[model samples]
Target: MKAVVTLIFLGLISIALCAVSIGDYSDKNHPGKCNIDGRILPPGIHQSPTECERISCGDNGFAERASCGKKMIRNCIPGELVDKTKDYPQCCLRYFNCNGEIVKA
Candidate 1:
């Protein structure tokens, strides 16, 4: 009986650790990446009108429309890129987990 109880306790501990370490990534609502739009986008914004519109959406309360978009641009800058075609600035790259260390992409 003692051995069985000890084994059960160890099994529970292992299961708990695994559950805590594994996270869901399939959910579209999952937190990831950064969206820089309107007023907060950095220099060298994209040239596509659609991109521009997306950025402007921020001013029109679009920021509150999508949770992920809002999460991405909450602190981003909206602006034109240097060539209007280059890559926009990345915001999520600067974030990390609870620890002060930076998480690798």
Candidate 2:
């Protein structure tokens, strides 16, 4: 009985440690967003209307600003890339009243 209880306790502790290691607990300011070295990043594509404007969360976890009119804007989050045409099709593609939706053009 003692050995069984000890094994169960160890298992629970291991599970808890794994959860903590893999959980998203960095962003204390913004929920559901990643806080990479104190910068909060959104999930989807972030855009700026002005050219040479500095985006808040650009470049994969590097806090770099991507220029407007570029073909692709690097997302701060890992494994995410935002197409400038899709984010701002009006400016890049000459479409009128584009809603910045992820749609097939």
Candidate 3:
């Protein structure tokens, strides 16, 4: 009886914790954030030091730029793609090189 009650309480707590949303934010290390639906991995950053930036992600860098909703990608100089599972062939690069810490938008 006691064990059953304890198990139920624990399950409820787990569900509540999982319900919390982390929004969209990711990087080379943290590839994604947990949201209401599920995990959401934001765009990557292709670092560049040259005057003309060359973002090689997909479709003229439009998709990557439009990612993260309102969040803007910056400080991406001489960037390189580290993780290819989530942010490869689609997402941006050098996510850690952003001007500031990664924030969910």
User: Which candidate number would show the highest TM-score if scored against the true structure?
Assistant: 2
- Candidate-wise lDDT, in order: 0.30, 0.40, 0.34
Q: Kindly indicate the candidate among 1 and 2 with the higher lDDT.
A: 2
State, as a TM-score between 0 and 1, how close model 1 is to the true structure.
Answer: 0.20
Badly placed stretches (over 4 Å) of model 2 are 1-26, 34-41, 49-64, 68-105
* C-alpha lDDT of candidate 2 relative to the true structure: 0.40
lDDT per residue for candidate 2 within 1-105, as digits (tens), equals 999999999877544432111224235457556564454666544445433233344233323343323232233222223344344323233222234434222
TM-scores of the models, in the order given: 0.20, 0.21, 0.20
Where does candidate 2 have its weakest 10-residue lDDT segment? 72-81
lDDT by residue for model 3 (1-105), tens: 999999999877544432121223333344342221222323444432321122223222222222211123455333443343343223333344445454321
Off by over 4 Å in 1: 20-105
Name the 10 consecutive residues with the lowest summed lDDT in model 1: 62-71
TM for candidate 3 is: 0.20
lDDT winner: 2
Stretches off by above 4 angstroms in model 3 are 20-105
Per-residue lDDT tens digits for candidate 1, residues 4-67, read 9999998775444321211122222322322343233322212333331212122222222111
Rank all candidate structures by their TM-score, best first, as comma-separated numbers.
2, 3, 1
